[model samples]
Target: METLETTKLDLTGKIDVVENISREDFLEFYMKPQKPVIIKHLYGKDAQVYKWTFDYFQKELGELEVGVFDDESETRQDDRSYKKAPMTMKFGEYLQIIQEKPTSKRLFLFNVFKHKKELLNHFKFPNIADNVLSFLPFAFFGGQGAETRIHRDMDNSCVFLTEIAGYKRVVLFDPKYSKLLYQYPYSTHTSIDVNHPDFDKYPGLAHVQGIDCTIGPGDTIFMPSGWWHHIEYNTAGLGFAIRSLSPHYKDRVVGILQVGLKTHIDDLANKILGSKWFDWKKNKTIERANRAIQKLQKK
Candidate 1:
């Protein structure tokens, strides 16, 4: 944000914000069309968005041991969200540390609801869609300046990400820009620092258009399936997402392949080739991005 890369970006693009929406309108205009929108104050009574704070979590779940990940890594596969995190600590201590100052440490895909089921009573799924997958909601916690890299969910599920506390800045791009995003082979990640995009190195970024917005406490964002997102925590914060299967059968099949087949193939290759496999993936991403750039030039 310090260096606004506005020269190439279409600053007019915006994510719709609404206080209320009918099920029919939600489906017709947003969900079916695969567009993103922010719903303000979407929760009911007992909403954690109002009651939960760092102090509240430290007091209640402090003893819980949690996986902690740092922002130092370059390769996404070597340090994936599905894998066990590199470090662990008591949730209370982690909270205490983040409250003190900005750090790279973050909590990803943590199932806090598994330990405290009563928390589920805080929010209900809107009638806008079916198959909410209520049982598998996941929480993401990050300290000030912590960032989740640019990536799409591998399973390609629609995500209802609700910000329970603090503020977060999100930048989203359609999957059509995958090559422009420098997406890695066999992975859902790109190493680009969206905060300070280097158009010189990744020229395709200069050609892509995306929507950017900041969500505060109690705001819920509907992220369509397969959309790429990059998130930055402006303050130490907590948010959770509930996902649903894509309505399209073709997308459902791709989701199955992404989770059940594509990941396995990458794991096998990593075991067989070690560091060389990662090198190959990085080189392949660069090669693909260059091709996309060439195609743009021809236009």
Candidate 2:
């Protein structure tokens, strides 16, 4: 495996500041570049909501109505794996649900935008409030020792993931590393094991540089679109995320096509060809990528 150094950029650094910038300044200076920035105190100054922790979530909203789905409901392996894991009842569930047991795996998707408007109002910042429509906030509660598969966001949106409670290990790689990462066909990411990578099986990954960051409460990580990121929650924790599209014309066009057409294509392809089609597409894409790599190496 090719080893690359991981760079750590502090959230408090000047590169990440966006405290009082105007909307035009933000779009021109920061949002356009797709560069990752950590805004310190961007949420607020002396905001008591910052003090809100996982325990508080469990206490205040844990008992709210929840919906559950398990292995039997979804045919996808991702769904099965999550169902097999143990999970507890999530607090204030607005969407879907599936539970297995405690301490295994569980997820609570609190539609904070719909259900907890009061909580959101508490942390509203004037600068962001003016542009609040540009962002969406949701809280995730994962049971201890839960893992989210390595995947990119929909429409290749840029993400700002803020840790509210507990700790999480994040692994990030640039889009150029896609081949080395053994990414899925037509997908933005791979299934390469982060803790125990097999370099010989996937030799191309050696060219990629990955940055590892462990986040705690009040810490935010900015991940650009097309960046491959994998997150693992060490303990039960809550995360707030905002996903936004770039102002770039190309990105906007691609985003619209992805949401409007590509999603339907995926669904149709899956239904018509079944798993065989998925396998064929995946392997063919990998083969093409590998061939491209070989050509590059010849230079």
lDDT of every predicted structure (CA atoms): 0.82, 0.58
**lDDT of predicted model 2:** 0.58
Q: Each prediction's Cα RMSD? A: 3.3, 5.8
Misplaced by over 4 Å in model 1 are 1-12, 45-49, 72-82
The sequence of per-residue lDDT tens digits that candidate 2 reaches over residues 41-81 is: 55665776678765555567667654433323344442111
**Per-residue lDDT of 1-299 in model 1, one digit per residue for the tens?**
21235445543468999876888888888888889999887665456555778888888899999999886653444324446788899999999888789987899889999988888887777788776787899998989988887788999999999888889998889888998788877777786767676777776777788898999887889898899888888999988999987777787787888899888888898889988888888888779988987887788
- Estimate candidate 1's RMSD in Å: 3.3
Worst 10 residues of 2 by lDDT: 5-14
